[model samples]
Target: MTSVPTPDPGPGRQSRPAPHDQRSRPVPRPRPPGPADEPFDLLGIGIGPFNLSLAALADGVPGLAAAFYDQRPDFRWHPGLLIDGATLQVPFLADLVTLADPASHWTFLNYLKHRERLFPFYFAERFHVHRAEYDAYCRWVAESLPSTHFGQQADTVRWNAARGLFEVDHTHLDEHGEAEALDRTYARHLVLGIGTEPYVPEPLRPLADAPAVPVVHSAQYTENRERLLAAEHITVIGSGQSGAEVFLDLLRARPAGYERITWLARTPAFAPMEYSKLGLEHFTPDYTRYFHALPEQVRDRLVPQQWQLHKGIDTETITAIHDELYRRTLDGGWPDAVLTPGVSVRTAGRLGSREVELHLEHAEQGTRSRLVTSAVVLATGYRERPLDRLLAPLGPALRTDAAGRPAVDALHRLELDRSVTGRVYVQNAERHTHGVGAPDLGLAAWRSAVILNDLTALLTGEEHYPLPVRTAFTTFGLGGPPPAATGTATRTAALRHG
Candidate 1:
């Protein structure tokens, strides 16, 4: 098997450019048109962690023909937000395939072993690995997995009624990212894992686009760090983990008495995440099952009330920020920094060629104020990328919820017309149907296993990946007996004599 050569380790995140000569590269070449006629067992649209997990697991199953495609030249995960010392919130066990198949060669432990860092990682006793290291581990898997194809952009997907398969059109890009050729392939099943994109609120959207100042989403913080630090004043918007990390980093880098930074959030407070033992059960498969069974209205109402589950800052990050501020006061002076919650940007305008004026409002107090800053960082989080354009061909066959979002079933299949026999699966795109676990890394392996099991069940008569009978100790709802109960309950009505 051919393999992509790994790049040398560097001080920061590192990635190798595609080979200058495509002919000599190990990257998969477009197959002949006649060979594309043979349908694959599974064709994945995106190569994010979720699909990467599926590919890793699928590699172990014999005779399973699977292929994954990504538009980028190589794998890179949130590269800009990989702040130094930042760690994944999930444990290392939440890697691509360990939770589902611990014996798999693609596990994080295996990656460490391959890199000769196993002993050091073992001695560190770190449950949460650094974010940059995780990215590197994913790249290692992508480079090694034969089923993954990079530099291929999936343009369209449509069901072929006559062929009883799904046809996917793609453009194969050359080393320089120019479209060199177009190709089409067929598949019996499809999985969409395009993932989410960073979002900037309406009030700050203009500033983020103008680029006159150092205004950027926290997703691009690393790229703009030097310019932001050199500015006279900086203001960070949003109180989530990313906002906190950026603020903390800037605070530490600036002089104690001249920090000149302001942090603002619309949330009532800079809250710590709900990381208690029982509180975390919401991320388990059990909770996902319960959420999927909920009525549309109920699920819509409940999601906003559970913001602390996924949107709050980690306790450690909050503590680090506080500790840095406290340490600055050791010389009998406070740091020149302001941290305010319950505040939001109402409107923003340019004060001059280089300064930004933000009109702010306090939600609780109903007070208003204005502030001018040389730079702004919006860490307002991300939203699911809309699938309308990609799935436009099959729009008529899709079933949508009250809000017009695709209605995803418990099995993660998009509800579609009965005429469409080939299944359309999704990953990290069903938060309304699957709850908070939809995008959580800890659930990636398990979700992949679930998808594989369902697909195999349809192909054969039995499941390929036996799902765990139970995952969480807490039962999610009261309508049914606990999952452990063997007996089934029957409801009967007493009829009155006429």
Candidate 2:
């Protein structure tokens, strides 16, 4: 029942830092008027965690001119999925700037200090913080940062051949998300951290798109939780953590004997996520480097097979679910809940006014059936938001791989034509190139450091953000190590810290 206190709100896009200590002192007022007409060293699109990490790390660097934009009026990470008692998958060390620079002013520890909650957090001994708390911590960082501009939507990007910079057009949005003004900025380098959008399966998209249907994607679960809970019978579809969490939440809300819920998973079983010590190495930089070096075909084949790594319910949540179900069974028979796996929703449609019918196919049993439910929650997960419209102006300069996907190099920079002097880097849009770590919070700080270091070295001869050469105990490939991934200057800086 505890809560973290928020700092005092100041006028527009800025806030007054708490008087926790000298470190909490306001970062100079009026926020530096960043090069209005001149090109910034880097202009990042999307202020999600990945790019937020970049912005935080860049704050500590001396002279890097960078800015981050997002369409949202304020920072909110997966707002709908912030189920009560649901914690982040990764530990707190995976916060905005801790892994890359523990001493950073923007670290979670610093945020805790700023909020005057260090003693509480220390005594609580909680490693993986609640999802809501993580969102609040990020909002704390985003609001305090002068370089991060929310309510700004990047509309188009083009490479200026003569100027050797990237020109970005953005729309300044008001509180209601309407475009208030047109603005433009130029940057020598661009980073896209647009992040992902909730993906409802095609079969269930119709009901979800219907204005009155009691169907929602897990991404918006919290928003529609009340409506869904009031339904006669609710069916939750998905095998990932979101589905598990949503099902668990619904079950807990319903009466003991009349749970009136069905949990359908496409996977063979309600399996636990891979969380073993060594199993987690796949999210380290070592694995990302090894995976990026492999031939494209091999890389493509490996991702789907490794789903349990990045996409499964944690044992804790799974145990909590079982415990709840077990508690219900103690009274008499089982709760009015049906949990089935290896089932796919072939199609779904509204049944007149008060119900929905879903045509389902059981994979292993080779059977088909229909399930009528009053409400549906599709936890089918998310897809990377397409960058086509935003980057269309780049045209031929934006290279692609054999799969027609953007070709991202080992440094996370898009492989573009040699004629274009500017670089376009990606954050979560490079899973095929960077392996599973592309979207992981554990690797967020590290990846940001990598991008910042590379970009800094381009401007100045020195590497600003030092990174360790080896991250994982496992040698990812048959080779001992991928050829030292950093330049000599960068390697030396990392070796000092390694």
On TM-score, the candidate that comes out on top is 2
Query: Which ten residues in a row are the worst by lDDT in model 1?
Result: 489-498
Q: lDDT tens digits, residues 104-189, model 1?
A: 88899988877778999999999999999999999878877767777777788899999999888787776688887777778888
The per-model lDDT (C-alpha) reads 0.82, 0.81
**Candidate 2 lDDT by residue in tens digits, 393-445:** 88788889899999998888899999998888899999988888898999999
lDDT of 1 at 320: 96
Residue-level lDDT for 177 in candidate 2: 87
Task: Give the residue spans of candidate 2 off by over 4 A.
Answer: 1-36, 482-498
> Model 2 misses residue 42 by how many Å?
0.8
Give the poorly placed runs of model 1, Cα more than 4 Å off.
1-36, 480-482, 485-498
